[model samples]
Target: MSETSDAPEAPGAAGPPAPPAHPGVGRTVGRMVLALALGVALGALGTATHRTLWHGLPVGLLVALALTASTALLCRAWAGLGTLAAAAVGWLVAVQVLSMQGPGGDVLVTHPAESIPSAWAGIAWTYGGVLLFGVVAFLPGRWFARR
Candidate 1:
């Protein structure tokens, strides 16, 4: 004997829900903008903290680079290539602007060879962040798949 239910089955009751559609243009743009803002904020934070030392170790520089790497990876994992590019550009721009000598002759990022030991912190912060961004951006896309 066979039995049949009187109620109709719901359209999607037999399978997993559909994957979400890709983001709209406005949302994508907004995400990229937020990414850029985050990058700028990170640059400022790194610049301010890249000169600290503890027991003759450049702990501040290490922290700055770690932040840079984390930010880049976050961007990539969040929205793919566009956000990553925006973040990298924003970070580089902020770092360069901060590195310039102010009217008072103060510099956020000094030449590595100019100071005995701490000066290298600035150089590392500036260039190492760029390198980190580049490396994260170029990583295999499969690694960042949204599955």
Candidate 2:
């Protein structure tokens, strides 16, 4: 005769960890709001600084793009797709509003056709932010799973 037993592994056992539970609606909403606020701030700051040139290099644009990607990655990793979308929407809204001509006819981000060097920097910053954020949001699902 043979005896066999089936039992679950202990918590400390070496095995893949369970996936994290979905966050509650309230928590999700909170995360979204915070992410959106951060995104808007980044957008404003990026717009203001994207025109800087140091030794003929667009250092400000590069830094702004890096910040945008980092922020989007944090939102995605923290709360998944919805939070990321909220952040992206916030950034887009802020950027678009700021790019528009003000009552006095001043524009934070000028049209690329204006042929100003800063104008190209602004255009790159705008499109580059979107590309970086989208790349972070669409990263492989397994990469974000709990170990």
* Candidate with best TM-score: 1
**Relative to the true structure, how large is the alpha-carbon lDDT of every model?**
0.89, 0.87
Q: Which stretches of candidate 1 lie over 4 Å from their true place?
A: 8-15
Q: Which residue pairs clash in candidate 2?
A: none
In model 2, the worst 10-residue window by lDDT is 5-14
Locate the minimum summed-lDDT window of 10 residues in model 1: 112-121
Model 2 compared with the native: what TM-score? 0.82
- Model 2 gets an lDDT of 0.87
Instruction: Provide the RMSD of all predictions against the true structure, rounded to 1 decimal.
Output: 1.9, 5.0
Evaluated at residue 13, the lDDT of candidate 1 is: 87
Write candidate 1's Cα lDDT for 1-147 as tens digits.
899899988877877877899889999999999999999999888988899888988888888899899999999999998999999988988888988899998887878567555777777788789899889978999999977
Per-prediction backbone clash count: 0, 0
Q: 1-147, model 2: which lDDT tens digit per residue?
A: 897758866779857789878778999889999989988999999988888789999898889898999898888888788889999999998898888889998888977788775788877988999998889987997877666
* Candidate 1 residue pairs in backbone clash: none
> Residue 103 of model 2: what lDDT?
98
